[model samples]
Target chain A: MNPEKVNLEQKLSRFDEHWSPKVVGELNGQHVKLVKLLGEFVWHHHDEEDELFLVVGGRFRMEYRDREEWIEPGEFVVVPRGVEHRPVAEEEAHVMLFEPASTVNTGSAGGGMTVADLDRI
Target chain B: MNPEKVNLEQKLSRFDEHWSPKVVGELNGQHVKLVKLLGEFVWHHHDEEDELFLVVGGRFRMEYRDREEWIEPGEFVVVPRGVEHRPVAEEEAHVMLFEPASTVNTGSAGGGMTVADLDRI
Candidate 1:
């Protein structure tokens, strides 16, 4: 095992993609990913996996079917499995996600924005 | 679903006990815990669970038999299963943990510091 810790900021700095998530750390079959969000992401739902989003900087608005909740920096929200949701950000938002390693960025919704394979930073 | 975001700083402000992790969120059978650390914790290893420690504030030192790693704010470390490790902090450190819900703080080594049940904040 590598003795060095994974510096999240250093990892985040290497990528500039708006929706692409870069894997930084993993444990217990879960992956910790860093991503920057701008505009609205695809509305999707993971049938078997739940997702956790932590805002590191800026604000993120989680758009559910019924309502929308804004998450400020240092706040987090958990989207349960099978719950359709979308992340919308007016400005660039630095975020961290904790979810299963098998989770796809677009979930079951296959589209142009779907990222089947994610990059590791 | 609550549709409300969990403010990490707000939850952190509610607890002052070190080593005792309070559950702030849960998804996919995994719990997101917040804890404060000061001084050295027990040397133990999880048999089936891998622990993820993300330093939210201050510095945290992970002690292993081979080497020591210092995790700074916005950094994280993954301690794999069956690896003996301990956390040492000279000053107060705020940390977030992402792991399975069944993971015990003391791992398989039970003692006074073992928290069988965690409180939600």
Candidate 2:
């Protein structure tokens, strides 16, 4: 394959759907995605692998059953497996997520919000 | 553990060594690191895994057996397993790298330039 560079702004321009993730890069067997979120995400959890949420721009908040935390730009959070949580962004926020390639954003609770396939950005 | 954010500038301030990677985050069995480089790196390759190099600042270059590529800020490159390549930076450059936590900077050809341990940033 030809060498490619994934610039943040360039990737953001390809997708306009909020909360929908665009695959930016893949390392080993994991996928790195960029998403723009402006509302609340459903409460869900992964059963087998941990999820990383890195705030690239704006502010985001994630609430777990036991606690809630705010993530500012340049910050990140690791949501452990099976820990129920929801992500909320008051304003538009840009995020970078790292997870296993098999992971689904909404887990087994598939719905309209679930992104069908990862498109290379 | 307390919730924390990893701002790129904040992480870079914690270390000053060029080419020595500092662990900025960990997910599953992999490590995310930030490295600053100038000059040339010893030619090496990982036997079991691929390596990712994301340029965060300045210009960088890499030479593979078949071709050489120039990487500018906001760009990245992936070196497939067992591919011999050398990374060179004309001026000081900052980069983000992702690999399995067990990966050594110099792999088994350890000597000088090998970082002792990954310190949290």
Candidate 3:
């Protein structure tokens, strides 16, 4: 397979769905995804893998069961495996997420928030 | 472990070495590292894993055995497993790299470019 090369701006132009992640690249057995988010995401956690949320642009807030924190552009937070957390944004936020190749955005929640299949960009 | 939350700006400030990558974060069993590079890096390849080069702040050029590519800020290129390649930048460039937790910066090449150990920020 020819290796895929993508730019943040280029990937951002390919999709408009909020909360749903579009796969940008893959390294080893992990996937890199970009998501445009607004409002709030359901509280969920991946039972077997850690999730990384890297804010590419705009502000992001992640609220955990016991604490909440704010992340800005260039900052990132890793939600440990099996930790329930919700992500919310005051406005449209562009972010990159890193997780295992088979991880679901909503993890085991399987709700409206769960994206059925991963879209490759 | 209080899951570490680091901004790219904060991590960049803690190290000034060129070519040597400082580990910023880890997800699953992989590590995320930041490196400031100038001039050229030796031709090398990881026999067991693919490597990701995300240009965080400058331009990068990677030359492979038969092909080459240029990447700019906000852009990323993945060098596939076992592809011998060399990375070079005319001016100082800042980038973030993703690889397996134990993969060295220089892969199997044990040289000065091979950082002794991953430095956690």
Give the best candidate by DockQ.
Answer: 1
Best-matching candidate per lDDT? 1
**Predictions in order: lDDT:** 0.90, 0.80, 0.87
Q: Show the colliding residue pairs in model 1.
A: none
lDDT of 3 by residue, B1-98 (tens): 33556789888989888998988988889988999989999988889988988888879788887777888888888888888888999898999988
Give the C-alpha miss distance for residue B52 in model 2, angstroms.
1.9
Candidate 3 residue A42 Cα shift, in angstroms, is: 0.4
lDDT of 3 by residue, A7-116 (tens): 89988999888999998988888999999999999888789999998898888888888788888988888888988988999999999988898898888787888887
Which is the leading candidate under TM-score?
1
Q: Estimate, for each residue in B26-61, the C-alpha lDDT of model 1 and write its tens digit.
A: 887889999999999999999999889989889989
Task: Please give, for residues A1-121, the per-residue lDDT of candidate 2 as tens digits.
Answer: 4455566777777888887888887877888889998999988878887788877678888887778888887567877677788899999999888888878888756787787787777
TM-score for predicted model 3 compared with the true structure: 0.96
Regions of candidate 3 where Cα sits further than 4 Å from its true position: A1-4, B1-4
Ranking by DockQ: 1, 3, 2
Model 2 regions more than 4 Å off: B1-3
Q: Fraction of native Cα contacts kept in each candidate?
A: 0.77, 0.49, 0.79
Could you report the DockQ of all the candidates, in the order they appear? 0.76, 0.53, 0.74
Best first by lDDT, ranked: 1, 3, 2
Off by over 4 Å in 1: none
